[model samples]
Target chain A: MSTPVLDVQGLAFAYPDGHQALYGVNLHVHRGERVALLGPNGAGKTTLVLHLNGILDAGAGSVAVSGLPVTKDNLREIRRRVGIVFQDPDDQLFMPTVRDDVAFGPANLGIRGGELEKRVMEALDKVGMADYADRPPHHLSFGQRRRVAVATVLVMEPEILVLDEPSSNLDPASRRELAEILTGLDVTLLMVTHDLPYAFELCPRSVVLSDGVVVADGPTYDVLTDDALMAAHRLELPFGFDPRAIGRR
Target chain B: MGQGHGHKLHFHGHSPVHRAAPHHKLLALLGFTLVVVATPKDWFAAYGLYLLLLAAVVVVSTVPPTYLLKRLVVEVPFVVFALLMPFIATGPRVEVLGVSLSEHGLLAGWALLAKGTLGVLASLTLAATTEPRDLLLGLERLRLPQQLVQIMGFMIRYVDVVGDEMRRMRIARESRGFTARNPKHWPVVARSAGALFIRSYERGERVHLAMVSRGYTGSLRQGSDR
Candidate 1:
């Protein structure tokens, strides 16, 4: 098989206060694959996502994006390859205008002038926010702001698009709209979400993290259908929403 | 979600003043205020001319006089100070309408009111015409320190976020039947304030991490190459 776009091997980390967030964890995502990282609260989902982009250094093991290790020296290139869209769009869209926010990542790489404008517009266009390039992020609807947040990372053209709780705050229409957009994208996806239905619809495979360890890794259908496994990990589907009834996309 | 309008101070218009470059307007505001401040307090005619000039600019800018007047309530404290100047200041005495007054004090008071009013009016005009984003760009063009500029940039971007968070906190408090109507409730308010500060600090840390994830090294590279 071709090299996995994202490779995490035995990755572990503890906070400065000695709260161990992640134990030894191993995962691999190949090119153009969508994998959901499912876990309950404090299961080290955010800790693992932070490690993927060097925001948090690993205590042991390694994380590599397309064969490039995430390190101080390779941070710039690594960040370019691994784009993490935070759960709250407010945290990500910090620039004064949508155009500036979208251009921020590429501009940091020294992209300028017409090239920067083109990249910004293209990303906005992809998210159907082309008309809002000049709007302040605060003026946007919550869902629009979320889409703009996605564009901010997309402008960088990352190899692996890491989304942290992409559907947390969206209404049903916005959720469906975002799902459509995500399904159409070509990049590798690593989504950390508790939205079981979202995981079923978007990601074919799922990894269940419990007590900072990967307890289950298999098809989304298999993971969601395992009643005992779901019960043990506190991973519950919305009441009466059956994965078998909906089936795989 | 309803708070999507641009800055409240800004009035949308296509007047020539609005079309003028922000840096140019900033410099003009500075020049006008300095000239007003430097003029002798006794030069009542010069002050009137300055007012006329400002009034003309206001007319050109197309911002309503009532809009400017309503916001001028911010100047009430200064007005009180100016009004008290004549009564408290020691100077040569004079009688006007059978009331004792100091001649120099009257002039000083007049000067204070005139200068303060002119400065406030001019600033309002500038703010009413230029968008907040453009004002930041104008400051950048004026060679303001990049760090300060970035601070203001972040403040503009996150002010709404902080405000929304505060609103939610207030709603949560109200839902729990908490209200600070007197000094007895001070501690609750203070604790809420403390919580907000900590939350904002944590948010700052998260924002920094987000910046780092996007390749922000130390200083922002925006406008450096442009």
Candidate 2:
């Protein structure tokens, strides 16, 4: 296979208060693959994604994005290649208008003038928010703000898209819309989520992290259907969620 | 696209003032305010001219007079202060409506009222014509400190988020039968305020991380390329 779009080896991290979040975790994603990172609360999933783009420096292992190691020297390039859609849209869409928010990443990369506007427009179009370009993010609904947040990253043209809890606080319609948008994108995806149904719908593969370790990694359907594995990692499917009934269409 | 959350001052219109560049409007308003402030208190004619100028802007911008007047309520405290000056100042006395008042105090109060009202009116006109984002961009173009501009940007962006959080907390407190009807309930309010502060701080950290992940180096790019 071609070089992995993202590769993590022996990654370990702990908070300043000495609470270890990740312990020598290892993961890899190839081009155009959508992988879900599933875990119970405080299970180090967020810590792992933070390390993906050098937001959190690993205590032991190494993380490389698109063949660039996430070090101090390569952060600018790594960030350009690994776009992360944070859990909270409010945290991401800090610009005055949706257009400015979408332009932010490219502007930081020294992209200016009409080219920047074009990039902003293209990203907004991708998320179906092109008409809302001039609207302030706060004026948008939760789902609309979330779409603009994705556009904010898409303008960077990152090789890998990492999303944290993309479905939280979304209405059912918005949730499905987001899933559709994610599936339509042509980039490697690493989604960290507690929404098991979302994982089943969007991701083909799943990796379960519990207590800072990869407890299970396999096809999503297999992982979700494994009652013993789901029970062991404290990942409970919603009541009456039959994995076999939901075909991978 | 829709009514912006918590932004009530800006009146949507397609008038010349609304279409004018934000920096131009901002500078014009600043210059107009300075002129109004510098006008002699006894130059009542000049104050009238200033009022006419603002009125023309109001008409041209198509911002409703009633809407503009309502927003002027923000100047109520200053008006109160100005009103108190006429009663408190010690000066030569004058009789008006069977009440004796200081002549100097009357002039001082007039100056305060006229200048303050003009300034607020001018600002309201600018706000009604321009978007808040454009206003911040105008400040940046005016060469204000970059850090100050960014601080203002973040404040505008998250003020609603924090406000929503506060509202949710209030709902939670209310659901638990907590109400600040007296000093005895102050502790609960104080504790919630403290929690709000901590939550805001944590959100700030998370926002900073999100920025870093998206290649935020230091200064924000002023994207008025259009």
lDDT of 2 by residue, B68-120 (tens): 99899999998998888878999789898998888888899999999999999
lDDT of each: 0.90, 0.89
Candidate 2 backbone overlaps, count:
0
Docking class of 1: medium
Q: Clashes in model 1: which pairs?
A: none
In Å, residue A71's CA in model 2 sits off its true spot by 0.3
Q: Which regions in candidate 1 have their CA more than 4 angstroms from the true location?
A: B91-105, B219-226
Question: lDDT, candidate 1, residue B223?
Answer: 36
Q: In angstroms, give how far residue A249 of model 1 lies from its true place.
A: 4.8
B1-226 per-residue lDDT for model 1 (tens digits): 5474777789999999999998999999999999999998888899889989989988998899999999988899989988887788886889889988888778888899999999999999999999877888888889989899788888988887898888888899989999889999999989999999999999998888898899997666333333
Residue A215, candidate 1: alpha-carbon lDDT = 98
State TM-scores per candidate: 0.95, 0.93
What would the DockQ be for model 1? 0.67
For the predicted complex of model 2, DockQ is 0.59
Which window of ten consecutive residues has the lowest lDDT sum in model 1 chain A? A240-249
What RMSD, rounded to one decimal, does every model reach? 1.9, 2.3
